[model samples]
Target: MQRDQGVPQPRLLHIEADYSPAVSKTEPWVDLRSIRIDEYLQARSLAVKTQKAYRQDLQHFLRWTDKAWSAVTARQIAQFKTHLVRKEEGQRVLSDATVKRILGTMKAFYGWLWRCGYVDRDPTIEVQLPKLAEPEADNLSDEQVEKILAAVAGTKLCDRNLALFAVLQHGIRAEAATLLNVGDFDGQRLWVRQDKGGSKGVVPLDEEGVQKIQAYLGWRMSQGEVLLPESPLFVSASRRNRGARIGYDTIDKLVCQLRDITGIDFHAHQFRHTYATNLVLDGMNPYHVMTLTRHKSVQSFRRYTKAADQQAAEAAFYETKRRKRKTEPGSEQ
Candidate 1:
């Protein structure tokens, strides 16, 4: 309290200060602090998978730098690259692609800090990047795909497996697949949530895919599972995990089971590659494929396109050789 004009007066409370009125007992305001790497990540409107990957990569960089963000230098950045490439017990700790990815994470993180005025400069601006090989898009052959479908058809959870396979056939990422709720689909279209830097769009569903999903839903109802708008489209079939939506690891195990049964070694991502390759080989417009695949850039879409071209060229070359051999005398049919 203060005396003003010979009258007692209550002191003015500064709004920005930590003090609050005692009468109401309201919650305190958010405590503002200095910028942090985690704060940068939280501010970013990145996809869940991208945010997770970037966080893991930044954590590795932080472990190496062993100092505050502002204290890091370009020299330390180079050293971090060397550290990533260094061998541990006669094996390289990180692959070339992984090293590049780590550098990318650093570039993004430091760039953010610089923009936020927390750092004087981006140390990663001049850091040399590892020369990475062109990514190879591995996909399954038609015969192998047929084998997987056949095995799933013969499985005990036939309806569930069929639905999963239909989803995989569309090249949907496992995370996006798991995030799918019952209302994410209509009879003919699927509303996909965005993946890493991907666009969210309604993709057309094949009749077979829709049918399999409906069959699985019907089976779930028969098993006393509640079918609601917010319910998971795909649920765990195991007793321990029953009625809960399948996770990425569980989906991985499901694909592994297919591999074991059919002796075809492949992962969920390979199915995506297969689907993209099929689109390219079938002469779908590149832009259309990019839109359907939700790829943000043509560069990513081209990886599948390039792979398809190589496969087509090899097929044509073998056909030419076959014709030449048949034209020659005494060639077997």
Candidate 2:
């Protein structure tokens, strides 16, 4: 297969000492896998975490194959699927969903190789992967959101923590939130310079979220923290990583802290789910919700709608009972 004309070729990155296209394909296949994976990844604008995940998944496939690339066929792909699901003593039995993801990675890998003219046939093409169940978005109610906000309202680092929560509440992922810069906030909105799924744009902040972020920046200035365009929006206050760009670990730790204090069984991602759910419940257009959530695919946006539909059905049932009780004989109008 000749390289597609419109496909934007990505610059080579992370080349290893042992990686050379000139190296014979008959050698250990790791070199070939790494080179091809790098090329495959660089061709598209995937998130850092996404790219890393692809690398890991593809590497696992390469190791499992344990043979020359050209020799793999649909039968080997099926065998690999069995290897993932078997409950043998040493074999790590994966859930159907996980196995499905791995198989997806395999299809994507071979598909790319075929498109890039690295492979003649895609062994994963005919092999079937399990159909996944509809994903349910977590429900973090409005009251819970208020409780989370109020929990930090009196703290000394109130501005800082509130700013972080504001960003999360507005639907920014923890990793992307951590990657924000001081100048990313424009008083009215946040510029999500980097986003998952290659969908980067400005995420409009609610008035309260904007105020919290502005106050946080103001508080930093009061503490003699020099604010610069390039400064990390959130800095670590921990002794080890103090004044450095906040890490995703810190985001997790903060959620853990809040979970302990408020007795809320939630994690960082629940905020995003809540954000999307709230939008859906409020009758926002799906396209508008997708824009707000920065979802590039309708499939991704549909998860919240599924949960919202269930919630609406339950709400209507309760509402019907309430109306019937109100109109009962001798009941108050």
Candidate 3:
């Protein structure tokens, strides 16, 4: 028998043959100690959460390779992708989406390395990511959305929750919502700050949303919190932290509370889905919907369109059945 090199032996969780290129782990590898990964991360100006995630992802690769960024080859990157997708010790590991994210980060890191002259060549150039399944578009019905709004409307801290729901309904990100200041709203339009492309844009609020926001502002004044242009639109009500900008955790907790009260397992993103679906259902062009949602790509907004199409198809089918039943001689009620 030919003495086996350190070829990855077949395991219980068979990796697809396509990604399993013939490679040896014992091949010459360099440690990543010298790579200026921190400098790279900071240079990108990533959001705090995103920076943390990228660090974690890069750490996973470093630990796996035990090699310097310069010593890493495309083969190893491909192998790493395989390792991430396969089951580790009888347990399924990362999902395809996670694997894709990891690879994307690595590609960016290595590309940066090459640009900065840290490496002669980028190793992650040709690594193919697993196809990501189209995200399922889950949106609550208009009635369900109204019920959620009503559940928090006019209740204690109603101002806060009302603003939260309205912002979510308008499809603003939770982080963006948390950063909103009193001056961002002008009775009719809400200026969404720190949007994805690092620019501010205005979204028109309906009269009802504006009225509720004004009511909430009035309530804040009643409690002696002065409403200044620079004041945070949403603030903590506790005496200790009064007038302090509300953090994302507080917004998330509020969403969870409403979810518990309504028995609806929905989050802020679902509100965005609901907004998009409602627009599609109301015969608004998806292009226009994407414009309102500030989606950079049509592909991002197409999920809502697909969901709306399915709902419309089901409604038409049921309506046809109902009409057929009514036409039958003995089916009339």
Predicted model with the maximum TM-score = 2
CA lDDT, candidate 1, residue 299? 68
Model 2 spans > 4 angstroms off: 1-31, 89-92, 154-156, 310-333
lDDT of 3 by residue, 106-210 (tens): 999888889989899998999998897787678887788878888887457887788777888887778888889999999898898765545367778887788
Please list the residue runs of candidate 1 whose C-alpha ends up more than 4 Å from where it truly belongs after superposition.
1-35, 47-49, 88-91, 224-226, 311-333
Prediction 3 global C-alpha lDDT: 0.82
TM-score of each: 0.79, 0.80, 0.80
Stretches of candidate 3 exceeding 4 Å from the true structure: 1-35, 197-199, 309-333
Instruction: Encode model 1's per-residue lDDT on 23-98: one tens digit a residue.
Output: 8776876323223756977897787778788878887876665588888889988988888999999999889889
Worst-scoring 10-residue span by lDDT in model 2: 23-32
- Per-candidate clash tally: 0, 0, 6
lDDT scores in order: 0.82, 0.85, 0.82
Rank order (by TM-score, best first)? 2, 3, 1
Between candidates 1 and 2, which one is better according to lDDT?
2
The lDDT of model 1 is 0.82
TM-score of 1: 0.79
As a whole number from 0 to 100, the lDDT of residue 20 in candidate 3 is: 61
